[model samples]
Target: MMPVQVVGLGLDGAQGLSPVLQSLVASAKLLVGSDRHLAYFPDHPAERLSLSDFHSALAAIVRAAEAGVSPIVVLTSGDPLFFGFGRVLLSHLSPEQVAFHPQVSSMQLAFSRIKVPWQDARLVSVHGRSLEALTQALQQGAEKLAVLTDPTNSPGAIARLLTSLDLPWQYDLWVAESLGGEDERVQQWPLAAAQQTTFAPLNVVILLRQTQAPVLPTALPLLGIPDVYFASFADRPGLMTKREVRVLALGELALPADTIWDVGAGTGSVAIEMARLGPASQIYAIEKTAAGVALIEDNARRFATPQVRAIAGRAPEALEGLPDPDRVFIGGSGGQLQPILSVCRDRLRPGGRVVLALATLEHLAEVSAWSREQGWHQRCLQVQLARSTAIASLTRFTPLNPITLVTLTRSEPSPL
Candidate 1:
């Protein structure tokens, strides 16, 4: 049996085909493609089958092949396997049973037409899928993105999504339509223009991060700001509280805190979050390192959470100056866990709570023992998180360090 040939075509139709591909198409005994795809080759003398339903199309292709059809060609747009129909074909047909002839993908053509290197660009298809991946990518501050869109997930929808993310960085959208065709359209559009204007049905959008500060979104995510948005200490890039751990830590904080003391606040991740949650509340971020104190200020400005006040000095000592706190989060103990808790025990106001994110068993053990000794009300949550990342050609979940959050509140004093 002849290997079923899957030929990829651009919007330029027959004009886009190479001499070799034209001959292959001309020689087919059975041709299969969408209505528009089949219309490209009017002169061909092949049994034509419209490819509407994959299951039904596969049945016809199989029947024709078993009956000794020669040169069976399946037409698709762009590199058929790249977010295209080739993957579906290969799913049912054995690798040996199908041969894929690919054109430059829409993603590829969009990048080239825009004159940018896409080697590092994150590519997502909303053609027939959800926008979850696109949302995640933008929130992560991906420097470049190439999106494949259908009528439903059009450029306008993408423009709306971009504006709604409330990102620290700004992005500009580039829309490319009917690529490789005589009537191809390519234009860079401000998000507003892109949203209001109608575009060619066949289009791809390139989202590029602008260098200037973003016009801050009116509705930024109060929680779950990606760690990338926070500027970290040059020396300790990975030391800051991760979003997963920070979020769990924040939950224990209890909302609408009057005053928050973030002890050993490295890069001020937790502190900034506290400020975001309660913009009117007082937030004092105490960090031992001078660099950490400065970074806290920088991130505070970026997030526009002015309530975050960075105090330079270690805890137990730094706790001396700040007013009594309603909520306290100890992200780093700096080898003074017990003494720090000593201060928290002494100063935490009535109805106050302290939350500790401990990375080591020794610290958890120390915190566990300390809470026991203090006779304070205690609650604990152990968090283990893994994030999916690309490795070579496949995705793998990279595990973050395990974190244990211990929440403590002083029990009402015994009646005198």
Candidate 2:
């Protein structure tokens, strides 16, 4: 079989082809491409085969090869292997039967125009897939993204989707249209503005996270955050879990939790942190006080974590209507530590962890007894954090109340 030569074309069209690539195209016995590509060579002597859709094009290419067509050429946009038809052709055929001449990918061009490095960025294509993948990446705290959009899933549609998810505040969007062409336009727009504006069908979207953005969406694991970063009630400045204690509790909860419950979630500090740690998971903040609920909502919004949902009402009762959790964090048990632990233990999936952070010995004794009764594995840690303060010209260490964290993991059933 003759080696099918796949040539990558940029927005510069046929004019952008190098001398070597131009000769290869001009000398082809048969050329296969879309009508737009075929239009580039009006006076060429090669027999033109215009086709749309991948399946039909593959079938046509097979027929041409069987017909003894020598020096077949396929025209594609940008780098044929960078989310292009050349990859499909190679998959249907063999590497030895195909040759690729790649141009600069649209993603590369878009990033270059914006004058930013994309080596650390996530690349995605919504050509035929759902926007959920993009949403997931954002929730996971991706700092940079380059998405290829199709006609139905235009830049405006994507913008609308982000705004609908209350994500407009986190990222800056840039739409690069018709690169390398006379009508080329590369413009940056706030996600809100992009939702209302329209762009050409052929475009790439670049999303960059804003500076000092609190939400940790990327793969860099965020363990602990200081108390100063969160909001607290006027009468309770130090009510929330300190960063040191939060980190220890998080380690016990494990990672990639499918479902998480933060019981007695005061101000949702622990809940928000859990959501950040496991962005792909769903986290529920169960709070009894109305003020606590309001604060949880505010903090979740501030972090731009849609996965953290604040539920107002007391638990083991509030936990009734919610989904079972793989990891549970009980920051305040409302003096019902035993009953709450029982409910959480019963609701936890096998191997799931339940972490309780308490300020007293009574709560600790109750949790330890419950763990032994349930035949579950348990671990205990105590955190005593103190911050240094300035008393006059000399530095003084201010002591914080000690906290105890009890971790219980539901043991797997014995083998049959």
Candidate 3:
């Protein structure tokens, strides 16, 4: 059987359609496409088919081809291979039976109209898919994103989703509607403004992440940061681990270029640091408190750890249905330490390490005993930090809360 060609007609107008593609459509014995696509070829006498009913249209294309139709032209928007009907058609018809003629996608035009480079941007389709995926992508520091909007998943809904997550206005959005049509329209605005505005039904949303101006280099050492780097809540008030303690805890975990779970992650200090140290690793900051979760997100952005995942909800309960970890750190497990430890230890691959930070000697003893019972090797450290302060007319030192660190490594062979 002769191959059917899937061609893209650029949104600019009929003239935007490639010459070769137009020729194919003109010579085709049968044409299958959307209502908009069919309107582009007014002079063709072929049996025009509407793609609104995809199953029937597909069957018609197959039947016409079997009847010796030399070339069946399938008209599509943008590049056929990019989230278009070409993939579905090719899956049913043999690849050898189809040819693809690509054109500039609405997403590409949207981005180009805004004059932003999209090489590093995350392109996602929100058409009839889970919004959770989009949430996860944004949470993982997706700077720029090209979202394909549908009737059910409109631009307004997407904007609402971002606003619900309290995402900052770090993006400039370009909404392109009915590209290539007489009613074509494009609107550009900051994310904050875009969230308040409504867009046309057929549109592509392009988000360009805002860039910060460069800062002069500082002379201070890089590893340990001062206490002020984090956003703290009044109730916990200094409950977050100190900068020095975080550095030591990160080292003890010996995180690898894999997945690390910061269970009971508070303010995501440890998780953010791990992401900074292990550039190739994914750090999951699992926190139970809403305030702590928000702090983790703020800290993650502040530290430029794009791969850190700030997860809301508590440990063990929140840790349900998470990916297995190569390293785990428990910072604030409440009283469900045993359950959290069990879940993390079970999820850790062989050779995986788990680090626990306890505030009291009693908790340290409990974890130590638990580690021995689990047949894991353990090491403990008591960290006491003293900061220089001015007392009256002289300089003095004050001791902060001491932290106990417990490190554990599983000796069992990995099944990865």
In terms of lDDT, the best-performing candidate is: 1
TM-score of each: 0.67, 0.57, 0.54
* Model 2 regions lying over 4 Å from their true place: 167-169, 214-416
Comparing 2 and 3 by lDDT, which wins?
Answer: 2
Residue pairs in collision within model 3: 11-180, 288-313, 288-314
When 2 and 3 are scored with TM-score, the better candidate is 2
Tell me the tens digit of each residue's lDDT in model 3 across 115-167: 77888878898887756566556544477898887765666666656555432
lDDT pick, better of 1 and 3: 1
Per TM-score, the best of the predicted structures is 1
Ranking by TM-score: 1, 2, 3
Scored by Cα lDDT, where does model 1 land?
0.83
lDDT of 1 by residue, 1-416 (tens): 35589999998888888999998998898899998999998877888999878679888887776666777999999999999878887777678878989998998888999899999999998888777788777756777999998887789888877665544456779999989887799999988887788888889999987644334456768797876577765434455788888888888888678998988888888888888888789999998888888888888998988889999897788788789999899888889999999998988989898889888889988988998898998788989988664322234555777988988989733322
The residue-level lDDT of candidate 2 at 110 comes to: 95
Runs in model 3 deviating more than 4 A are: 167-170, 180-185, 190-196, 210-416
User: RMSD of model 3, in Å?
Assistant: 17.3
